[model samples]
Target: MLKIEELQKRIDELLLKAGLPRHSVNLCTAPVGDGTPYISFENGKYNYIFSERGYEFFRKITESTDELLYWIMSELAYKIAFKYELENRIEGRDGRRIAFPKFIELMTKINPLWKLKAEDEIKKTLSASPYDDSLYL
Candidate 1:
């Protein structure tokens, strides 16, 4: 299971280096199929797909996709609590049995500013979310 505390620390460090605040990110999650792994964010609104396979995929991609490191970190952070929930097999007590938005929320807070090479698909993904707007602004 991924440690939220450790991941958060790393995020904080990244934000410090990026010269951004730490309140811009607010992680939030919602139900998607049996499980989902798509990351999304809007103005004060956040949604992402979550699943075990998604986590594994992230781990694999993050390992080799250093260019997408920030996105990978943000994605991993949001999934931390969810990972814990799954690892512990804890039941949903407060409607968050599987929801873990704090991770991405942290990223938004840090206001990560990354330089993503302009590619149709990448631009579409980043622009589609509030991430690029927040980062550039």
Candidate 2:
């Protein structure tokens, strides 16, 4: 039930805030779950991980975990997305998804090699399943 409009709405809500809790922080990415999305405080910043418990998410084509994680991220997520201006990164069929590479860059402000670890895992799952999210990935 998640839509790009919804995601943009969430991002817009945060943009109204003007800033985040930490001026110097990174929203790092990793294949923490099976693309379920997770929020964890690591090092000096918070990590917004594309999550899962393993392959359960990969095996089924169910509701979008991206929405679930955004929910999990709560207001802090709003602030981060607001800080990075996630509204600009969203694109897909009817604008329903976020580009993964730019998403990683928005967090780490560097090449998205770290996202590869997570992408590799997601790639394997998508490869085995009937789902082909590469267009959105």
Candidate 3:
């Protein structure tokens, strides 16, 4: 089972790899969705929100413990999430930092499977735990 704290660490790692400061993830606020693991970023203009369908897929991979399966699932999840970010647009707040949408898009395209795989792993662990809570995005 994946603990929330561990999941958070994985998230932080992804954010760092994505070129987003690790501080961006607000622990005080809910990161994942109602039933899925989703993240939302807001600047001055628009809010960047995305779901973690990849996480659900990840849980399946982890359940089996097949490294190759896990790798493939992880790769796919990140690709889908990154693609969503890329195709979408976000309003930049200060005009200095890259808008959340743009950042997501760029990260996804560069290493679409990186952060996403980690996120999926965490989400899967969360869902499988005894205290299961639905977090659908």
Candidate 4:
């Protein structure tokens, strides 16, 4: 079984590799009876909510660090892309987004595994939570 402290360290290391600040994303487990995944950002930090299933996914993914890193890149990049899209929608910016693509590119650079896991594959991994739109982006 993986300890939370070690899990936190792997996350922090990944963030630092991506040139992001440690604890910039607060990783948390969902409460009992609340297994649906969720995510939010405020106070300059991302609240990454993980249900029991999500945590298990993390544990399983860790056996292969490349897979773990790739998954993290996908989720974080997608979340950032969603944030930009939401902002653009609110601000009525031009319907052009260069950032999202670059975000994915950076993530891929950090851990190149797009051929192994596409966006569709990511969607297939998570449950049918209403939060999919935000999470899968």
Best by lDDT: 4
TM-score of 2: 0.25
> By summed lDDT, which 10 consecutive residues of candidate 2 come out lowest?
93-102
Ranking by TM-score: 4, 3, 1, 2
Error of 1 at 58 (Å): 13
Evaluate all candidate structures by whole-model CA lDDT and list the values in order.
0.42, 0.40, 0.40, 0.51
Relative to the unseen true structure, what is the C-alpha lDDT of residue 57 in candidate 2, on a scale of 0 to 100? 35
The residue-by-residue lDDT of candidate 3 on 1-137, one tens digit each, is 33335545655666566565564543322336443333223332211233353333222222221232234334434545555544552443222122323434544543565446444544565467522123211
Per residue, candidate 1 scores C-alpha lDDT tens digits across 11-50 of 5666565454663343324334344444343333322335
Error of 1 at 89 (Å): 49
Error of 2 at 62 (Å): 27
lDDT of 2 at 79: 47
Task: Report each candidate's C-alpha RMSD, comma-separated, in the order given.
Answer: 15.5, 14.0, 16.1, 10.1
Candidate 1 wrongly placed segments (more than 4 Å): 27-69, 72-137
Better of 2 and 3 by TM-score: 3
What TM-score goes with each of the models? Answer: 0.28, 0.25, 0.29, 0.46
Q: Over the full model, what C-alpha lDDT does candidate 2 score relative to the true structure?
A: 0.40
What candidate 4 gets wrong by more than 4 Å, as runs, is 32-69, 85-100, 113-137
Question: Whole-model lDDT, candidate 1?
Answer: 0.42
Q: What TM-score does model 4 achieve against the real structure?
A: 0.46
